[model samples]
Target: MRTHESGRLVQAALAAITAAAAFGVTACGSDDSASSSSSAEKPAATSTPAAESGKITADSANKGKSIKLGSKNFTESIIIADIYGQALQKAGFTVKYDLNLGLEDVANKAVEDGDIDGYPEYTGTALTALLGVDPSDVPKDEDAAYQEAKKLYKSKFGFTALPQTPFTDSNSLGMTKQKAAELGNPKTISDLKGKSQNLTIAASAECFKRTDCALGFRKVYGLKFKKEIKIDVAQRHEVILKKKADLTVPFTTDGAIAANKEVILKDDKQLFPPYNVTFVLSQKAADKLGPAGQKVIETVQKGLTTPVMSELNSRVDLDKEKPEDVAAEYLKDYL
Candidate 1:
């Protein structure tokens, strides 16, 4: 009873309706009903959608959504958190910060308790500290470690770990250039084996207990220091510079290393696990962020290679720039 033109018109109308329904389903879902598996499996997009036009612009879908971002009590963590927060803000999400949230356990609890929607975390820390995986059992391969941590996070806590950043900030033995030269320029931790007996090493008390720290130096590299001084992580570079300690445990990406103030002794035996950065978000928050928001988070991190991150840290630690300001400057290109 219908003409050919009428049938085509009906089909078009139905297609429009179907498209609208699909979008509506995505926009309105119960907080708990969202599945993290899809988001987790989706590879991070290499390009920023909002920046395609040469400037970041707000998405209508993200305008009303809010995300609470948190970070551990460290300069690098805070800088990373600020980067994520500012990028989300540009995408029209109301980002609330809960920075300096203490240690890994405290930050984990904050995310679990909904005190924060998410935070940037190291894959090694998440595997060992949060998931109870032994550090030795943690995968040495970066992608493999990230996947294991992501799967465990979802199963154990119903959280989602977004794509990892390009950089990996693992613990390493560092000493001043002068001290290294004095030690005959030991190029690797193994080179310190026989010489360690005369060197005074310093690190946080926890480092003495971790297999990846003083324990690893002793076991894996057969290095035993003359004296192990318990010092805070903040004083790592200072201790070496002040000559209080001949060597100190520092993160590979420490600003001091970037500034050439300290030399990282290579882990020839690979004692430390990969500590790549991943943003851990609640299932509910991940669902609300959806694919577009997740892409924004991933895109901004694409530029954060080890050297780039080290420089960013140097800006804050050496240049004394605020993390927020440093983040803003870094995001300018994306904006």
Candidate 2:
């Protein structure tokens, strides 16, 4: 965890590093295993069709010389890094691995310093943590958020995000399926308007005042809670199960939603900015990867969907499977 001051210090360091480095790296991966690293030996891989077309042919570029993949310390981040690393390897690039790169500050600074090529990052994380944008200032819609993030990264940090995946691990309002059906099968946030006053909401103590939380709900969907109860997120589902609260906020990829058979309401009015997973890379690295590497990354992005990512997360968080194994399984059809 980082204090606001520490976070800003990291942002400052990243800005300095980005300015100093002459070469940058891009991330790509999937399937065959490789050891983790801040630096490591090149992993072996077979060429895929994308690489065979000579799109990522070694002779075409030499700035970075090698593609080094980095990932944050979470299961999801490690798995994503593997996916990118494997794809680049199959695309016939000499790839290196750097998993468990700590928090966003550490990871972003590593990228800026040319310690690694690229990594998967969420838009919301970048906006608030890196760009210093307030949560309320984040664009509500996904495309708009991505576009704005791209511009912010380029202008502020000397880098940009690759084309984004369709899946977004964003905040969502959830209720038991039974509860939703009882309310005439409410599918969108707007559907809860009239009935919300009869319901209790469960969230952190300060959520009601946050523009991206209760305040956004009230303004965007006209929601008015009968009671606002401070509840720890881990116990949110339990509260609903015990009939203490009618609604709770859950991450879109939360396993509890499936376990409890809860339905996440659609944010039809786009009150919250969606955090689509994307590859964050510097222009130096992007140029090195050339058209072939870029195509591979975009292909991987096209394959990911909300349900797909949720299931992948469940396999690790709920089933306790190795993220590498899960990612490899998904990559069987990923390209």
Candidate 3:
């Protein structure tokens, strides 16, 4: 067995290497295989997408007015909103924040009802969850995928789809370092599909039924586990660490993913939504915030990436760091 000190050193090195040059695994499978994909492995993927379509033009109402920025009830979303609000303020636009606004329905409804002018969302989610697309499955190509969503949003909701950051934070598979090493340097989702039957998984109670979690991954990926242990969302990491499960399904941008350098399995098949947190504004909010809103969103996109966002999330949600202070520190980097 490796010494604890040796393990710690190895983990530290892995974290440093990944932070500088991130990696991803992409497999080609269908929705049916998605839920079962845990049993397979695929080639490691580079996070860069093929190409993004240009932003679509639309009618806007800009008049240098202040806007209320709303965020969903999650650490990362609230952090992004803070970054955005700060950016807007820097650009001479008055900004208000209603942080932790729950899920997209709440945020989208608020915008539509004119309670708030703008918020952030992901492309795949914006299409299916917000716009009601069929299948409710995630898209394979980020750039091409969001274009369909962009059109849907403009035609249906009268909202502007701003530039989407190239960050995908969603449900995914992960393995322990010891397990990874014992498996002889496992790296792709395809590699695990056939092997998952021998391992157990632990996750939030809802994960077992969520399309992106146990369902989508198993259906398309063809992974069959020995067992799945349902635990509270906050207890997932502890369960995994205690060896209750061989791997855990965690959000891609989760702080745990970063702090522990947990190996995120490559989603050879695009099974989960691209929750890149796109900035959006109501038609009226756009008219009022205009260039101000654009600049704020832009700064946030530059400042927040997968690693940085994951770290910030851990600080607030896991470490119990105050949200406002966390936001201030991140904003200082760009402000």
Candidate 4:
């Protein structure tokens, strides 16, 4: 539980963010009342247990006796990485971490080279970004996905993918609070049908090109934007604030959206793939953790959900809480 102490510091920061996220967001949405309250509200839905999703294999037992944890450069990766590190630590293995690693390619190289164990990745991101496969047209759920990804990973390299969860933090659509009200779109993708085409959008070149972001929304919702503006990634808030873009792409769990009070549009057509955060374990490290790794897997398997992950992300990115601290505090809440 020593990790808990570290986590509490994160929780305090998250609590502060939860209390003060207004400074970071651009406030997009038609539902101003609901959007305004999302930050202050303690989650509203009742918890429903998710079906089992991960495993600690004999291969893993013999392999992950001691593991290195890796993470991408993003805040969510940092938090998830800290959780993975603490879980391995509690399971009785010594963990070394290499957080803030660049991306899947870098993390994959590190894991393959035995520099780090494994890290979290999204199903869509791996298939679309890393592997050059199109997940946009596939069924928008997780069944057979782990198996598909495992085959690709093992065949391409010696790595392994653990069970995936329902925790999704995918790209979303957002507008200024006033803009949302002006648009009058609500509750579904079709709501914007005749209008979105006139609104200018701003996002990453990737987001603009990706199926889930622009294409999917257009196809599924029968809507098209009048103009699309490409900007550097992660700078949507600034663009929206300056009115450079009429609408922008946002992440559902992103803290900046909530902090700025940006009104997020609903994806009624379910155009996005479910990118439940998953543990992509390095084969080398899995061998060192032994049976204790299974316990760690179980602990993680029991908690992560869309709502849970969304809040955690909001805390770290918007609230200014450290990812490591948020992970630790989250473990305390569920453990």
TM-score of each: 0.81, 0.65, 0.69, 0.71
Model 2 Cα displacement at 213 (Å)?
Answer: 5.7
lDDT of each: 0.75, 0.69, 0.62, 0.61
The TM-score ranking, best first, is 1, 4, 3, 2
Alpha carbon lDDT of residue 283, candidate 1?
Answer: 98
> Would you list the clashing residue pairs of candidate 1?
none
Model 3, runs deviating above 4 Å: 1-64, 134-139, 179-185, 203-210, 226-236, 317-319
Summarize candidate 1's per-residue lDDT along 1-335 as a digit string, tens digits: 11112234334433433221110001111111111101111112123245343234567667667788888867788888878877777666776766777778888999999988998999998888789888789999999999999999999999999999978999988899899889999899989878889999999887787776677788777887899999867788888888999998888887677565678888899889999999999999999999878987776776676766776777667666677766766665222
lDDT of 1: 0.75
Top-scoring candidate (TM-score): 1
Off by over 4 Å in 1: 1-55, 258-260
Which scores better on TM-score, 1 or 3?
1
Clashes of each: 0, 11, 46, 27
Task: Please write out the lDDT profile of model 4 over residues 107-164, one tens digit for every residue.
Answer: 7777778776688887767766665667555447675555667667767777677777
Estimate the overall C-alpha local distance difference test score of candidate 3.
0.62
- What is the C-alpha lDDT profile of model 2 across 1-335, one tens digit per residue? 11112233333333433222111123333322322344554543433232333233233243235788788755567777776765566555677878877767889998999988888988877886678788778987888888888999999988868888877888789898878888999989999978999998898654565556666788777788899898754565788888888899877876668777898899888777778888998788888788767877765545466666766666666666666666655655333
* Candidate 3 TM-score, C-alpha based: 0.69
- Across residues 160-259, which tens digit of lDDT does each residue of candidate 3 receive? 8887875777777887787888777678777886788898888765567656667665777788888988876556567777878888877787877656
RMSD to true structure for each model, in Å: 14.6, 11.5, 13.3, 11.8
